[model samples]
Target: MDALTSVTGDGQHIEPRTEFAPLAVMALTGGEPAGGQMVSFFVDDPEGTGTDFHGGSPVRVTTASDGTGTTDVPLLAGEAPGTVEVKVIADGAHTSFSLTVNGHPEGNSGA
Candidate 1:
């Protein structure tokens, strides 16, 4: 079966206006790493002008010989705190990640 599995940068937290760990994913087919595959990563805008993918959304990355596709640029958090969703898609399979901007005020997400 074709599938996508998150390799890193999932369920992580970052400080406001800071950089996050690069998100990574691997494509698997029949339970084997699928190298040279093109993976697309889409980031959700958490707080208006805050938080964003370093190179913008739907970043495309090519899997390496190890079948791991990692986002070359890091995700950026805005001045506010909130959670963002990142989706990865490849080979007709997809997966998602949740990143939270942790800080004071708990739920004080800016528009």
Candidate 2:
């Protein structure tokens, strides 16, 4: 099976300027879930912009043997703004990235 990764937003309103870093790259060698392992992705606040992921711990992205993964991580809540670092880990290997969070209001956006 092939490994697949995706990012999704919950029902919460998201800004149009929201951006995503690249997924941590990895090489799968096992045959399937039985022998295969799980991969993880992390998101962190670098500049301390007050975003969700900034003050709190890093968000994690995990991959199962099904070769499927979800990156439904959340960042800060208020309008402080901040940067994010995305990291992925697999089979002892890992990668990371950083991104800026833009400003936006909160409400029932038709998102």
Candidate 3:
């Protein structure tokens, strides 16, 4: 069976409308790298107050030699406090990254 998992940029706390770390996923089939595979990214913001893929959702990318796929673009927090969900799909396998857009950063008074 193939596998897809978020290797980074998951369960992070981000401030509203701010830039955070990059997201990446690994695609493996039978415990081996699934290179040259096409990985698709999607955004699930039910509150409509979260981020999206830079050019929009459903961004497609080909995995590298090490079975790694990354979002080459930037993903910022939305206009309000909410959770942003990024769903990664790879050859019928799936994984996800969740980020919370909390209000205000440390030492910021929202002034």
Report the lDDT tens digits of candidate 2 across residue range 13-83. Answer: 33433434323333344434322445555555466554444334454545555454544554544344555
Cα TM-score of candidate 2: 0.45
RMSD after CA superposition, every candidate: 3.8, 8.0, 3.3
Highest lDDT model number:
3
Better of 1 and 2 by lDDT: 1
Candidate 3 least-lDDT 10 residues: 102-111
Candidate 1, lDDT over the whole model: 0.83
Q: Please list the residue runs of candidate 2 whose C-alpha ends up more than 4 Å from where it truly belongs after superposition.
A: 1-27, 30-36, 53-62, 72-78, 104-111
Ranking by TM-score: 3, 1, 2
Model 3 misplaced regions, further than 4 Å: 105-111
Please write out the lDDT profile of model 1 over residues 47-92, one tens digit for every residue.
6537777767878999987789999977788877778888888879
User: Which prediction has more favorable lDDT, 1 or 3?
Assistant: 3
TM-score, one value per model: 0.85, 0.45, 0.87
Clashing pairs in 1: 51-78
- Give per-candidate clash totals: 1, 7, 0
